[model samples]
Target: MDMTLKDLRIHKGLTQIEASRICNIPLRTYKRIESSVTYLNNPKYQYAFELLDKYVVNKNNECSFNSALVIGAGYVGLSISVLLSQYLDVTVIDINKDKVDCVNNREPLFKDKDIEDYFKNKRLRLTASLPNKELYKDKDIIIIAIPTDFNKETGLLDTSGISNLVKEIRTINKHSLIVIKSTCYVGFTDSLNDKNVMFSPEFLREGHALHDNLYPSRIIIGGDKNNKKVKEYAKLMQSCSLNRAKTLYMSTKEAEAVKLFSNTYLAMRVAYFNELDSFAMNHDIDAKSIVEGVSLDPRIGDYYNNPSFGYGGYCLPKDTDSLITQMKSISNSELISSISHSNQSRKEMIAGDIINRLNGHGVVGIYSIQSKKDSDNKRYAAILDIVSLLKDRNINVIYYQPHEMSLDDFKKQSDIILVNRYHPLLEDVKEKVYTRDLFLRD
Candidate 1:
């Protein structure tokens, strides 16, 4: 039915101001729509209304406390919380009370422009508790989004967390469909013989978590083909969609392999670009221009070609290591090991270049120690290796982020500023600043 704009506004239960705020529409235009002075005659306005309708469910009370719980409140967990909120009453349980509080207050613990509105609008509930047996008992969906750090010495993922969560869920929520979102080895999920279990691998980037979840390239679900639970779970996922993304179904083992191999491919690309940049830097060539020229070719379109210390983020580092470790056990796969070796080599090369640049006995200030630019996070930041390399040679290293550092105080304390990217603030000290960011954008 083509209802009047007033009827639609009332049905959505939004004041014109509130609707304008949520939709990014001009307040005056929204006011005109609400007042019947103007109609949403254009297709663009109609499309905007439809987009909002998809996210903010009209039947507020119809929310089924079809209880869903996300085990960890990290980026992936947060994204899933927002995505699943439409179909189920979702809650995120985390160890950190601060993170839980942020979620409960509908504030993002991390910065993601796409999810900020969802958080602010209380799309999902969040809590932090010592995870009692009762909490998981009645939940229909339980997703594990915890970190699985790779242990270099053991050559395996430290997945005691996953094991513990599985045991606990089996005891408490035997009927709940357990979805493993944590990245794991190829066959790990298949080995778990739990009845209501499946793997749904996440393909989210570090900064663009929610956007990727909402508008995913593809949704990969894995379980026994005949299981009703698996099929129903996939349908439930589709029903909550903000983006009409594609879906792929496979066995649990294949799904797990897809996640690992996908991340490893990204890591491989990063390593390739970093090495390319290194060669260009050695010859004093414009790396970015060369990359732009090469990428303009249809086969090698420009994306993810920016160079850095190495690929060291939440997914790429650990997934590559785990895939390599798992591949090594078979003795048939050699390429996976080489890919991992190349990653390590890239980091080593960056460290070697830094070491060769500095006088072995001076203090060097590291401007922004983050692994990625324009991000506050520093988990597995590749700069740590270069820092360690410098420290071992008795070179004192000072850390400072532009946002965190006071301009006057930072200049007073540092001998040389080692920046990944050149900044105007270091104009006077440019001679002492060492960086390879010929074209700074990550």
Candidate 2:
């Protein structure tokens, strides 16, 4: 029996509008396609049909690797190291001795349940060491998952570490396939001028790093797609993932573009919703109602729409700024350029709202500093920006995180409490709590 677009969409748990949006088609066109009014031969519908056909759940036979070396023990590196160790003899090298010790002890340097579980339950053939030529030489595959933080002064991604490391790796081991998992500028790999090197962008969320690696949505390997080593590396990654995610091969520059564009789009969505909340606040409208009403439209769905002080985390701020910088030479970068500004405006708006609520003359208590609930990372957290903005106005602020202080004591010490996300712990003091967390979720 032949399947229609609607059938495929329904099977995927998507509504017609959601499917249309995914296919980048109009609702009417999608309706026509579903009703068999549109011909499959039509060029407009061909790509959508192809996309649907390619949407099959990927299931591939497991592949194995003999040995691998992963540099950097940050979330990306550590998770990849653990995942690969399940099949390959993996060695993780980091500059930080504490991080190495933590990994050696089977303790994650950061908060991640999956990593903890893997350490406890899995017989991972992994070892941690400081970078050395001896450790680098014997590895069949060397993966670079180092940080490339955005440099505000240079107005570009700081790839100095990546550049220096690649040079060192080449010196130590000339034949090992180098896979870069770091977020870098577009054309960075092309600039390296090495055919043996490939770029494979990681798509793991903070706090859920290992879980995401195990059940990835997709895996993208960017390099010589026809190369045997490249294909083998892709297969190895696919086998490690619990889902056996669909893998895509493209040029390195395209892979870099994919990473930047994907993150920027998420940042844009966050800024869009924050702006919407700002508008609602200004107009005295119900922001939650507006968000819910808009989200009911299948195209919008209902994830990552929660409003906060701003879109501030390790990735979004830097990635968005890097993408904006990358687009400087381009003619039409208005929308891309506006994302960072929008995020900044949202932070300012949030601060202004809090100040207005306090009448600019009361002790304020900060609930937490982490970017998101249950996350230990405070890197570029939106709440930090809001706190800075308030302090600039000479408003005295105190903080009480459950991690640091008791809730009863926190309530007694503050006149007004500022919470980014509402918690049940604050229920007793809800009257004194000021928050924009309408949905009560991250």
Candidate 2 ranges beyond 4 A from true positions:
1-64, 401-404
In Å, residue 2's CA in model 1 sits off its true spot by 25
lDDT of 1 by residue, 197-299 (tens): 8999998876777867766788899887577777777766655544546778898889988988898888888888787888898898988888888789888
lDDT of all the models against the reference? 0.74, 0.84
Global local distance difference test of model 1: 0.74
For every candidate in turn, the CA RMSD to the true structure comes to: 6.3, 11.1
Question: What TM-score, over all chains together, does every model reach?
Answer: 0.82, 0.85
lDDT of 1 at 354: 61
Predicted candidate 2 versus true structure: per-residue lDDT over 1-442, tens digit per residue: 1345655565455678877887888989887767776456666666776565344232222343589999999999999999888667889999999999999999878888888988986678899998887887877799999889999897878988988988998888888889999999898889999898999998889988888897788899999988888989987886665554788999999999999999999999989988999999999999999999999999998888888778888998998899899899899779999999989988888888778877897778988777678677878888888888999998888888677888888898877888778878889999988777879998
- Residue pairs clashing, model 2: none
Cα misplacement distance, residue 12 of candidate 1 (Å): 15
TM-score of 1: 0.82
Q: In terms of TM-score, which candidate is strongest?
A: 2
Q: Which candidate is the best by lDDT?
A: 2
